[model samples]
Target chain A: MNKPGNLIGWLRKKLNGISRLWIVECLLLLAFGAVGARLVYLHAGPNEVRIQKAQDASEFTKSLVPFRGRILDGSRNPNILAISLGVHDICANPQMLTAATNTELAVSILSAYLKMSKEDVRYKLRFSDKKFAYVKRFVTRDISERLWTQITNNHIKGIYLEEATLRSYPQNNQACHVVGFVNNAGVGSLGVEMTLNSSLTGTAGVVKGMRDGKKHEIYTRRTEEIQPIQGDDVILTLDQQIQYFTEKALDDAMAQHSARAAWAVVQRCRTGEILAMASRPAFNLNEYGAETDMSRMTNRVLSVVYEPGSTLKPVTLALAFTEGLVTPETMFDCENGSWFYMGRILRDYHPYSRLSVADIIKKSSNIGTAKIALMMGDEKLHKGLRAFGFGRKQGVELPYEEYGILPRLEKWSGLSCSRIAIGQGIAVTALQMAGMMSAIANDGFLLKPYVVKSIASSDGKPRFTAEPVVLGRPIDSKVAALMRYLLARVTEEGGTGTRARVEGFKVAGKTGTAQKPVPGGYSETAYMASFAGFLPADKPEITIVVVVEEPQPYHTGGVVAAPVFAQIAEQTVRYLNLEPTEPVEGAPGAAAPAP
Target chain B: MARVNRKKNTADQQIIPPRLILTVLTVIGVGMGYLGIRSRCEQLGSEIKKLESSCEINQRRLENEESKWAGLMTPRSIEEALTRHGLNLTWPRRGQVVRIYDSRANDLALVDMKDAVRFAELERVALNE
Candidate 1:
């Protein structure tokens, strides 16, 4: 091999022979290429894969309204009686809409979907000066969806949809009283809405984000986002089917009897769950604003107080039985239809010289009822009725509920006891009368009436649930059973409420044909005909109270209200599928009695 | 003599060809130019982010609307619509339903299976009665 030094010398000589111009050219080209690559990266990388960032200060932010919750029926089916829907509030960016090619086409589409006059909608849209104006607010999601589709398909620009909630009653006027209505200003006003306002009104959301000039959110510039907490939905104890039937019956009765008003309440005997409570002259929850008469807004069943007529007899007799004063078989000497007692005359519809205590209730003998009241004394009678949830607030989940007028025992005169005994002096709400009857049906335990069943989260988890709250056992269970037995006789042949009988079910009820109290004395023409009853006498499932105020012509309870009671009870029993247990002794067409 | 000269020329050309070198530089310059264009598209990037957020909000609103619309088309509403259209459908009477109670199981069953088995029995009873 050659010497190592000779190879090194050769290599060095080759490198040294290269031209400086060529070397400089290569170096400069490489350097320029590197710089070019860097420039390309800095420019194109931003355009191609630019990182998201906060937008410039030319953006807008808005408040997002949280949706209100639903009011459903009881635990079983949980049908939505009241619900909040994200209705589309169709707003027009008037400047953009006026600049559009087919603004008329868009306006016509909007008007048809919103159920508005096209001219009105066109007027709202033609204002080029307005940046934004409402064409229609709170249109149903159904109509809005169709409008949105039409807008998108036709490319009819400039109309924007803002998310908003509308309180909608899907059943319309079915349970209008209980479901209540919401104000145009987006607040609940009456009934369950007023009672559970806080729970129904949800927290609103605030978004501190940049928006474009076109009112679109600039997500990159978002600073603060507080998500809304939606409201908890309330569930009610009302059965929609039962409520519908009760309303229909009451409507017919009110119209047929030509009564000033009518109201009814149906309650679960055991739980005090108001299955259906309605008062006619009722307004539609959907069209609540259109109804000018505010009198229809009152829940007459719970709000109006009047003399309950003979419905109070069973309650008084139960008090007497509780006091060890009189048994059901105790005899009373009626002064043949009319008797002078304590300077006032007490009269019966039919003259009876002698009537048993049970017959006193059956005939609704005022003289007999007064003697029973006299035996109990004014103080005992007052205490008994009060214990039955008469004078005090029944603690129902309703606003503006009245506790009917019951005079203090000290204010009562000698005539007051006798008058009160006949259900004339004491003023009681239809609800209070129903509750007392419910006590008898519920083995004398007066439970607090509740319309709200539970409040649930969006995920169907219960936030709150109503438990059966027992107010008191006003009378003994045995006394209640005995009262049920005697009241059943009132619906039999020759009794006052023979018309109250259902074909299949044994009806236990009391009829009341009280004269409406005028400014001076009671009105002879105007009467509050009422029938309070429960069916399947031995084991009652439901207790109903029906009252027709100021009924015309045939105003007796047996005549005006009893037939309606029969219709309601029969339908209700069939709906509930309570088997026919109590059979008629003699029937035109009878099935063999069950063992 | 020609073969020897050609081999020497190939050996000299091995020092890095001018064509190859210029091609690589041109590629780098074009890549840098494209990157510069991409960096200028900040508005488009933000627009994409906004579109994504808008899509999310729209999806939430769609869900809420769908549920409400479904609820509005309940059986009762449908029936009312039918009634309005003059198609009358009466409510079932009590006798039509043959309720079977299983007391041992502590349950009740409402059986009326389409004008068939249970319904046929009801019809037969009706014709006989």
Candidate 2:
């Protein structure tokens, strides 16, 4: 305000000094601007590189996604014994949650939905300075949706959801032993699940996205993603209908006989395919946690071994006939129903004064069968048993199959040989008995019993198909036919297995009444009654074995096991629509064929 | 020379201002928001697909259970299952049976058979008796 030209002389001096000071200030401001620009360039250069590295890290993590597969049945029906369903893993940052209003309320609400304790939830929310912490795992879709709604309505912050898989079993207990179950991490635990786990569990997928300072997804900076590849499907050879029937039957028998346990198997003789197999006291696959006992988990049809009893007599008779040591007409004196052989008094159920080889089998005479075994000797008997698929595993694909006990010839005593001849000393599994019976039904050709028919990939292409493997043909076709004739007579009126006679079909079968061994000798009260047979003796098809343990009063094979065989055979014949060759003259044509 | 100077002053007054560049930048900002919305919609679509697949898996598991339950519920399946386990259904015996016969024989014939059936009176019995 002072400088108009008036104080020109004084103003000039002051203006000159101020001008110099202004020039110096101008230079200082330019220097400061240059320094600021340089600092900005330095900071931005490193930040750009850091941002690029972070983007690459996200891309790397996203590439590891894998896909899971499906499970199917023999009919190509989806078994889905275990499956992966989409779920969410919920997480939160406790420190950030502290600022959230009604924090305790939020924790309680989440804990209730997640099935966790409020204290646990609160503790997780309180102690976490880490950017992320798991609040809950395996949250279902419904719960997750409810959580989302809660978040939206309440404006909750610091919550997140991560994709995960939860396994489910559809057919809870149906075919549990066969279909098996999975573990917590979606790993197969048993049966088909364990067998085909590698192909069924899929790879996990990932997505790379920029997260905010709180690790929240940034809408703008999201980038690369990789999708999970789904696993291939496994198709089993189990027939659901047959399996259900088998299980039901076993359950009833176990209850009826007051048996400690029981097992049964149905096999197609020609194909060696196990149609149905069941053991009593089965468990549900869904609630495996309820019963984790090892005994209940076992598939007894393949694992347990017991004396096959009189059911095994047919194999001995067949072997005797095959080796030309005996024929249908060969007679042996049963010594008025009792005989002393190898210091063991073997007795017949009936005092058949004299019995031909065929009659010996029809009456299930222990004395007569022992005589036949003595004639064949131990070497030939052992060879014949081995050839019939006895004393060996059936080579089924399932785990934990037993090779039933068969003492070598060198280990056999005089009494042991005779005892084994009547099916006393040896032990056999239900599956082994079925396989042996299958050999007789299959024209003396023993086959490897297999439950799984085929395994297929997800696309329905068969990865593997089971072919009929002939273990051995122990006897000739003629011998098998002769044995079948002899067995059929056992079911005739007044014969041992009169109870096993079916109405419209000629059933060939043998009965077994094995006394359970006690501390000293045999337990008089406890018995294992079993019946193994094939239908339409002339042209055999299905081979079945039924074993019942500890019947109340009538513990004989003919009394307990034979009746069960008749019932199953009757129903199965009707189920398969097997045409009867010898229909009764006045009987109604079997069951009318299903349309 | 005077005319040229007036023309130059008019030209200076007509020159456009540079402040309009900010309007272009604002348009770009709006475009970025629209793109963000579009990408979010696409992401949601993919998530829906994944969820659909998961639903299918669950449905299949339920179907398997239903089929098993159906099999167990059927009467035939139950009966057959019982038989398989070891319970045998017994047929009616003679004690349980009621036999009804239609009699056509005369009483005289019954009397004659009774008299002839006796051992001691065989020789003494008359035809009338």
Candidate 3:
């Protein structure tokens, strides 16, 4: 403002300042460019790109596949008791479905096809805010296919199929109790199903797909998948054909005897594997709803508890003989058929003048048996019974097995001891009785009974296998053999179990007629008749126990139960194709009186 | 005093370089960007693992259902199904039988139990006459 030279100098200084500012701007831009280039290098580096690509590929390919296990039989044959298939949970986007063409008609058609009511469909469609709602779960393949056709043909919108699983039993009720039944969500409920549920229930897989903002699949750009691990298959010891026959026989017996209930079991004598176990009446596994709660239960040969009657006599005799307190020739006067102890009178079914230790068993004399028990004393008898697996669980591979009642020696009065000696006052289950018989047949060695043979993975590799387990030897083998000989006579010319004779088979068995316990004491009319025996008396194969409760005309074990044993033995021998032995000539007739 | 001032002014006239400042700014910016990118990668990896596990579970469930369906839809089961639905297959009676031939011996015989009985009766009547 003061001079021209001063004004030119100020303008030059301001222009120079603007040029320096531009140079500073250029330096800042260079720094930013280096930083941006470094960032790009870090983000798109080889390591980072490789990791991203691997992750995307894995996510895309791994999610949607599943592998389930198979259920196989003893022969390694697949009997699909339960399995999985591709199915769908029918769902809908309620708002979309409502806005679609022919909404009412679509809902009506879906409801009819799915067996759901149109009202339910309409109610779901009314939920406008709900992005998805399920109409039904676990639709079958046939139904799903039909639905897919219907949706395509009718142009229904928003109805979709999602993958799910459904369990089915092919044999249905054939092996229902053994194979067990699975629930709606594919959980095992009973039998082998529950036992091996963990191995049978394979791991479930998931599907992850790229989705839009509304959670709809957008071409599935990336998916993450993991394959499921299938469960193991269980192999049972049950022979299906044997099981069929056992069930048929039990059903017929139950109907013919007008029995309230009946149960039977056939076990391998050497090995404790149960070949067949049946109870009547039984229900179908597929139609579980149609059965009553009572029929749905598995008896496991342990449902009923009754006095073992004369079947217990052999055990007592075996104990006495083993203790050196009695010999086969040892004789008891039998009090001329009846004896009184502690104001209780015990009588034999037939009067015997005198019976040797062997004859007492052959005749099944109650008085004679009580006399032999008196010699055994309370402690040795109790120990012997306990060792024989009485008053304790037999350790079978089944649930809810009962340990029958055996009162302690201290609890037994003189009368109680005498009564219990002849199989009264003490109650035992049929399984326990059978186990006791099997122990004798197996040379005094008790075995822990089991039904499952092995558990294998879906690839046919064994996961767990069962072996024949010897529990304990309750008596000396010599004593068992002698007892076996005496028992064989019970099916001979003058024995009580004359009716239990099988042709060309040397049968050894005992007959039991236990009076039913009434309100006050015992009933004379009602009886629990039982016959327990091992076939081919010299060398045993199978041991069976047949119990008949309260027959109409005759309630004696020899008359009611022994005949059933004979029939079962004949059939079993024929079916097993067992080598026939020479018949015991002059075997007593079933009509003959007990000797 | 004037000569000393001239030498000091010449020393101050040397220019400062911008490389040091530029290097420092570039390091700070790159470090921050790398951290952000690393965090995004970790997040995606975890999400992918979760999705993978879920997919595995679903796949197993689907396989289990498929085997069950195949088992229930067998030929034997179909025949049983028909029987359950009350459809019975019956054989023709003796009067409807045509003839029987023994394949091994090439011998012709009566097909029906009733016809065999009738032929046996005719033989007995002829012998008696």
- Find the candidate with the highest DockQ and give its number: 1
Off by over 4 Å in 3: A1-72, A75-139, A157-162, A184-187, A202-225, A289-291, A335-337, A524-526, A548-554, A563-568, A583-595, B1-129
Compute the lDDT for candidate 1.
0.80
Q: Per-residue lDDT for A429 in model 1?
A: 86
Give one digit per residue, the lDDT tens place, for model 3 in A1-595: 7999999999888777477778789999999999998878767766777677655554433343333455544422434544545567888888788777778878877898889898887876678778898888777756776888988898888888887765555556655666666777567777767767777776766656664455434332445445566677666777655565566666666666665555667777767777666666667776665677755566647656788899889888888888888898988898888787778788888988889988898899999888888887888878888888889888765656788889988898867766777898888887788778887776777767777778787677888888666667787678778877888999999999999898767888899988889999998788788888887787676777877777666777798778777767777665554545543334333112212
Preferred candidate (lDDT higher): 1 or 2: 1
Q: How much lDDT does each candidate structure score?
A: 0.80, 0.73, 0.71
Off by over 4 Å in 1: A1-62, A93-107, A125-128, A148-158, A206-226, A584-595, B1-105, B109-129
Residue A340, model 3: lDDT of 75
User: Could you give the interface RMSD of each candidate, to one decimal?
Assistant: 14.9, 25.5, 23.6
Worst 10 residues of 2 chain B by lDDT: B120-129
Over the stretch A1-595, how does candidate 1's per-residue lDDT look in tens digits?
2999999898778879798799899999999999999889867766543423333445445676777777887635567777776667899899998888898898789878888898898888777978899998887666787889999999987888987777878777777778887798878899999888888888988878667777666565677878777788898988877787788888898888898999999887767788889989888787898899999999998888989989889988998998999998899999998998766677899999999999998888888998988988988888887888888889899978888989988999888877887788888988888889988987787777889888887668888988667787788778899999989989998789999998767889999999988899888899999999997788777889999998888999988888888877887777766666654445432433333
RMSD to native for every prediction?
A: 12.4, 14.8, 15.9
- Candidate 2, residues A271-387, lDDT tens digits: the string is 677767777667777678688676777788888888988888998898888778888998998899888765668887778778899888888888899889989888888888887
Ranking of models by TM-score: 1, 2, 3
Query: Per-prediction DockQ scores?
Result: 0.06, 0.02, 0.05
